[model samples]
Target: MISMNCFELFIQTYFTQLQVLDISRACAGEYINGFRWEQLISTSIQHLRIFALQISFKTNDPLMRENTIQQFQSPFWQEKQWFFICSSYSIMFDSYINLYSINPYRKKYYLLGNENTTEIDSMPFVVQLDIQCENV
Candidate 1:
């Protein structure tokens, strides 16, 4: 098994060729801050892949989520496989509200103009933007 840092590196280097990748605790705190990361992977003695990256704090912040989505939803990232997982409890709360409101019985009582409800509806757009950024 490789160390966390090295695993992150390997993912970056060979992400395109990889059919599967699992990462944990590699980018915890630093995930919110901008940083550079690299990865190298070898599929065989003669086959190697390398990827170098400078991560931007462009999409991780809640305040900038809408803007980030607008920027990344362009024609870029159309062909890459990407995933993003957010640990923000507040976002999860918003998602829960969204789900609750979606129930036919609940929708009748919830105010149509509620801000939190609106934000919950917008979460999928925000997530799609993050994915586009990673893939792009």
Candidate 2:
């Protein structure tokens, strides 16, 4: 298992090189324990997409998921884009399946709620962005 500091270093060093990073099979315990939202906003990579699946281990209580969702929906991140996918099983486990994206000139956010009952698929949950950039 990668230590928290190492994970932070890895993200800092490598996230810029990646256009998309998928960690669908990995558990959330490692990430939630070490991840700070502030750290993500500070990355040098101005554009990236992160897909995390089966990561509900952070939501131990009924309110936890809602709180996290609230943070995701917060307008404070008007410059960033985020997507979320919460599985029924993960709702019980408190693991979250979500995506984070960053772009300087455009933003998109998607929310997948508790309505879908399909079994988790091997395909990584992804949000396709159709951005039309305009020159400033």
Candidate 3:
């Protein structure tokens, strides 16, 4: 599990590129590296509400399967957008992502593999997330 301090630093660093309001916390000219951590977190929270993320992981190995689910449920991944890009600094996971949803009460996950297919294929030992939640 990632410690709170680590998570905070992760958030701070990940959001350093964000374009904040041109006010007291702006990082560029007329500002003094004034970006604040709270602002970065707020931006991330907003992104969570508005964006759909594409996440992928291999699960051929039993141990990896367990890790995938655990990572999915971690605090860093609770936000859907982060989960889509959290595995590695790779862009391939962003391809061919189709929106999907889950039923928490049923503990069931649904995937859209191909638009023309009617049958559910056997689990391919790979999990991909293209989840989209309504902005609230």
Candidate 4:
């Protein structure tokens, strides 16, 4: 299991030559913030052109989640033609929101409301992006 800093370091250290990247996973805090990702990409991966990722953020606060998702609407994302499709649902005490890039390598399949159901063939790593959430 890689910590957030370690994951960032891995990308910074080894993926500097990276032209494309595709990742999907549950995330929180800074990982869910688009501005932080923009900063990281700007400072670390100079050659990065195609970035496809689905960052799922879970919280009890809907307003905070909405605000966080707004960070992706900036020019840094738009100028790169990095549009996104977001999906949300509530599971017991937590509200889950997924922000995924809609690009050429964009995700086409989504599995919501069940985090434990991972054996499906449509999982994102091979198919591209998997935005999963817990059951409502």
Highest TM-score: which candidate? 4
Per-residue alpha-carbon lDDT of model 4 for 1-118, expressed as tens digits? 2455776885665446656666667766666777878888888775677778777778777676568658888888888787777778888877888888775564344333344544
Q: How many clashes show up in model 4?
A: 2
lDDT at position 47, candidate 1: 22
Which stretches of model 4 miss by more than 4 angstroms?
104-136
Per-residue lDDT of model 2, residues 30-106, tens digit only: 44421354356456434555433223344455555455545545553444445443332365545444433323233
State each model's C-alpha RMSD to the native: 17.6, 12.9, 18.7, 7.7
Q: Candidate 1 or 2, higher TM-score?
A: 2
Best by lDDT: 4
Candidate-wise lDDT, in order: 0.26, 0.41, 0.30, 0.65
Clashes of each: 2, 7, 0, 2
Model 1: lDDT equals: 0.26
Tens-place lDDT digits, model 3, residues 1-136:
2333553464344433332211111111111111232344465433333222233332233343333334334454454433322232224543221111222122123333224246533433322222222211
Worst lDDT window (10 residues) for model 2? 127-136
Q: In model 2, which residue pairs have backbone atoms overlapping below 3 Å?
A: 55-95, 55-96, 56-94, 56-95, 56-96, 57-94, 57-95
lDDT of 1 by residue, 1-136 (tens): 2334654553444333332222212223333221222112222111212111222332244644343333323332122222222222344334210000011111112122212333332221111010111221
All candidates: TM-score? 0.24, 0.46, 0.23, 0.70
Higher TM-score: candidate 2 or 3?
Answer: 2
